[model samples]
Target: MASDSLHSTVHQQPSPNLTSFPIILKFEEVVYKVKPDHRGLCRGRSSWSSTEKTILNGITGMVFPGSIKRRTGFVAQDDVLYPHLTVSETLIFTALLRLPNSLTNNDKIAHAERVITELGLTRCRNSIVGGALIRGISGGEKKRVSIGQEMLINPSLLLLDEPTSGLDSTTAQRILTTIKGVARGGRTVVTTIHQPSSRLYHMFDKVVVLSEGRCIYNGPASAAMEYFSSIGFSTSITLNPADFLLDLANGIAPDPEHASEQSEGLEQERKLTREALISAYDKNIAPKLKLEISNSRMDIYSFNKHASSRNDPTKAEQWCTSWWYQFKVLLQRGLKERRYEAFNRLRIFQVISVAFLGGLLWWHTPESHIQDRVALLFFFSVFWGFYPLYNAVFTFPQERRMLIKERSSGMYRLSSYFMARTIGDLPLELALPTAFVFIIYWMGGLKPHPVTFILSLLVVLYSVLVSQSLGLAFGAILMEIKQATTLASVTTLVFLIAGGYYVQQIPPFIAWLKYLSYSYYCYKLLLGVQYDEEDYYECSNGVLCRVEDFGPIKSMGLNQLWVDVLMMALMLVGYRLVAYLALRRVR
Candidate 1:
C-alpha cells in the first residue's frame, strides 16, 4: 500500500486506519511464532548457552507506511556536559554534523527555536547547560531536546529504547503523549519499553514484546488486551499490561509432564488465539491477498533498505573514512580545546615557576653541585610525571564518552579516534613545553650549548607524547572516569617510582622494573645534558676536585642521550598501539 503511493504523483493513500490507530511497523511473526519443542520458542531447550538462540525469530507482525516519518529525543540520567554551551550551540552542533551545508543561518535559527519552544526549554535558551540546571530541566524537556536532535534530519523510522525509563510518572506520561502526537502525523515509531503503567501502555501505537530472547507478540497496542482475553485469560482492572504479559510468558516455561489440565487447556487456547489473530488481520492471507501484499511490501522495503544505507553528513557510511574525518575535525577542535585547557594553564604556571626556580638556583657553581642537582630533581618530579596525571584527568574522560557515543551509532573506527588524539596533542606538547624549556634555558644560562638545550626540549616533548598515550591506554582499560582515574593514578605512581625520581636507581629486588621506567630515560637524558655542558668541580667537605680529568665524558654522555630519546620514541609509538587496542574494546 505504501509502495504504490510513493511511485505515484497523486496523494499517497493513507494505510487502512484502525478504528483505534494504524500500524506503523509490523512483525506478524514477531512474538509467539515458535512452538515449544525440545528447542522451544528460544531454541535449543531452556539452558544458559541456548538462551539467546531465537532472539530475532519470535517477532511476528508490524505495519507502517512509506510516507510516515519519526524522530527520537533523549533526556539523560544525571547529564554531564559543557556548561558554557548555550542550548542553541548544542543543537547547532548536531545540525552541523547532520545538516551542515543544507542549513542556512535562518534555517538553523528557525529549527533551533522550534526545538526550544517545542521542548519548553526556551526560557533557558542562553543559560548554562550544567550545574543546578541539570536538575532544573524537566526530564520531558531534555527528552524532547534529544528527540529534536534525532528528528532534525527527518527520519522515516525512529527507535527509542526506554525513552521515559528514568522519568517520574507525570514526566513519563508527558513524553509518551508527545510520542503519540508525533505518531498521529503518520510517523513510524518503534521503541523498547519496560514497567509501563496502564496509561503508559495504552499510549503506544504498537507493542513488540520480547521475553528472554523470544518475542511473544507484535501488533497494535490496543489489541494486546483483546488477544489475551481471546486466549481465556483475564487482565485486572488496574493491571499493568507489561507486567501481565511478562508473567504470562514466564508461565510458558512450565513442563508438559507436570502440567495440570488447566495449564494444558490454557496452552491449547493460546494456540487457538494465535490462529485467530492471524486470520483477523487477514494476515493468514488467502493465496490472492499474499501476492498483493507481497508486491506492495517488496516495493516498499526495497526503497527503505536503499534509503537506510545511503550516508548523511552525520550518519557516516564507512567507519574508516568517517573516523579519519572525525580525526581531522576533532584534531583541530581538540588542539584548540587543549590549548585553553593545558597551555594557557600549565604553560603559564610551568614557565613562570620554572624560570623563577631555575633563577634562584642560577648562580650555583661546581661547589653547590648537590644543591643544584636536588633542585633539578624537584623540577623533574613535579613537572614530568605529574603533568600526565592532570592530562589524564581532564582530557581522557571527555574523549572517552565522545568515543563511546560515536561507536554506538556504528560509524568511526576506534583506531582512528585513538590515532587522531595521539597526533592532535603533538602541537600543544611541542608548543607549551618548548616555551617553558626555552624560557628557562635562556633565563638560567645553564647551557650555552644551544643544541643540548634544544635536544632536552625535544626529549620532554617526546615524553609528553608517551604520557598522553599511556593515559589513553589506561582510560580504555577502565571505562568509567573515577575507576580509570584510580588506575591511571596508581599505574603512573608505579612508573614514577621506577622512574629514578625519588630513588637514584631501582632496588635490586625490583631490578626488572628499571627496563620499564619512562622516567629513567627522560631523566637520564636531561641529567646527562646538565652534567655534560655545565662542568663542575665538586667541593665535598670543602675539598676541591678537578673534574676535566673526566675529559669530554660530557660530549660522550650527550651521544648516549640519543639512546634515551630513541627509547622515549618507541614508548610514544608503543603506548599508542596499546591505547588503540583498549579503545576498540571500549567500543
Candidate 2:
C-alpha cells in the first residue's frame, strides 16, 4: 500500500490562531468498534457489551483538524523521551517517517526550526535526546516538539488521545495556543478530553457529546447550553460539558410514575437534536471538503545551479537526485541504532565478572568438585534465559508506537530491520563477550584451545540473537508490560529446567520440554568445542568440565559440529522468524 492517500473531502478554514487561512477536517458518520470479547470488563460489567445495536456499538465525532483548545486537549504526557538524540534527529526521524522526500533535509530542518521557534525550543536545538528530550528543555517545549513532529507531516488532520495531561494551566494554555495555530493553518485536529474546568470549556470550536458508544450531540460549544434548554433541561454555567453530557446520555433516576413520560421526552429530543446537527454539518460542512489537493515536491537543484534564492546543496547531475530513488536516507540514524545497546554494555560487564568469578571457581580444578560444572550450567542458563524472558515483557511495548509508525509508513521492511539489527548486533556480541570467555576459560584453566575459545564466543552471540527474537515475539501479543514480564519469567523457568540444568534425564511426562530448552544445545555445543577442539580434561583435570551430551536423542544426533551448528542456526532462524512475523503487527 502507498504510504499516504488523500480523499477529496478537504476543507479550508481559519481559527483564532490565524487571521488568514487554515484547514478544517470533518467526519461524516464515522464509527469505531471493538469486539465484544475485547470490551472492558472493569465497569462492574457482568454481561459483555452487546454484539448488536449499531447505535450503541460506536462513536461518531467531528472537529477542526490539528487545533486544540486550552480546556479541550488530548491526553498526552509532555515529556522528552530520548536524551541521546539531538533535537534535530528527533525531527529528522519524524520527517523521514512521515514527510515525503520532496521535502529535502534543508526543508525539514527549516520547518523543524520554525516549529522549534514557535515552541520556544530553539535554544535547545543541539540538546541531547533522552527520555522526553528533557534535560535542556522544559516539559511544555517537549510537548510542542511532539506537536512539531506531527506538523512536519503537514497533516491537515490530527487526532490526539490526550494533549493537556501532566501540564500546569499556563503550560497547557501555551500548548493549546500552538494547536490553535495549527488549525488556523488549515488542518483538522480532534482530541478526546476528560472533564475540563469551566475556563477551558469555552475554547473548543465544537463539542462532541458521547455516552457509552453513542453520539448525542456534535455541534458548536456555545449553543450547547441552548440545545439542552430546548429539551427542557437546564445546564449550569459552572458544570463541565463532559459531565453534563454524561448525565444527559444516562438520564435521570427512574421514578415509576413519571419515568415513562420523562424517558419519552428525552429520547425524542435526543434523536431530533442528534439528527438535526448531524444533517446541518453533513450537508453543508462535510460537502464543502469535496475538493482534491495534491501536494507535490519542487525540483530545486535545476532551478538554481548555484545557491542563489534556493539553498539546494544537491547536485542535479548526481544519481542521488534522480526520481524514485529509494535508498536509505539517514546513515547516522542506522548507525545510532547499531552503535550502542544497553544490553551490550551490560553484557560486557557481565562477561568480565563471569570470567573472573569462573576462573576463581575452577582455580586448580583438577581436584574441583562437580559443583563447578553444575554452577557453569546454571550461570549460562540464568544469564541467557533471564534476558529474553525479561526483555520480552518490555521491548515490544516501549518501541511499539515508533515501530508501528515507521513500519506502517514503509520506511523499511520488517525482514530488513530484523536482518540489519541481527547483523549489526552480532559483531557486538562477538566483541563484548569474547574477552570474558577468554579471561574465564584461561584463568579457570578450562579449555584454552583457540578454536574452542572462538566457538564459545559464537555460542554466546547466538544465544543473544535468540533472546532478542523472543523479546520481539513477546511484544507482539501482550498489551501490558506486566503481563509480558510475568509470562517471560515463567517461560524462562521452563526453558531452564528443561535445559538439562536440573536433570539430565527427563521424565516421560515432561520429556517433550527438552526440545524447547535452548541451553540443551548450548551445553552440547560448548562441550563439543571443549571436548574435541580444546584440551579441556587435561587442562581442568577432572573438576570444571562436564562430560556428556545433555540430549534425549543423543544417538540420533549428527556430528557434534554439525548438530550444534544446525541447532543453533535453526533456533536462531525459528525465533527470528517468529519475531519477524510478530513485528508485522508493528506495520
RMSD of each: 8.7, 9.5
Model 1 residue runs over 4 Å out of place are: 1-57, 63-84, 100-114, 131-136, 184-186, 197-199, 210-217, 235-297, 301-367, 371-375, 378-383, 393-401, 410-458, 477-494, 497-515, 540-556
> Could you give candidate 1's per-residue lDDT for residues 209-323 as a string of tens digits?
5545444455567777676676455644556777776655554321234344796786775555444443433442233333555666876677667767755333443332345
Query: What is the overall TM-score of model 1 with all chains considered together?
Result: 0.67
Give one clash count per candidate, in the order shown.
26, 31
Candidate 2, which ten residues in sequence have the lowest lDDT sum? Answer: 291-300
TM-score per candidate: 0.67, 0.67
Give the per-residue lDDT of model 2 (tens digit) for 1-587. 00011223322321222122123343445566554563565766755656644444333333422121211223234343445667767776655544444556666566666666666767777775556423456667677777776665555455565577777878877777676665555455666666655556666677776654555565677777676665456643456665665556554321224344576786765565456544544554344333211110122233223335543222222222223222244334545643546456576676677678877877744423334644563465457645544544565576566555555434454555555544544555456455656666566655556876777677766676676666657766674687777777787778777776567667889887877767666666655554432222322544534233323223223244676668767877877687677666554
lDDT for position 14 in model 2: 16
Q: What TM-score would candidate 2 get against the native?
A: 0.67
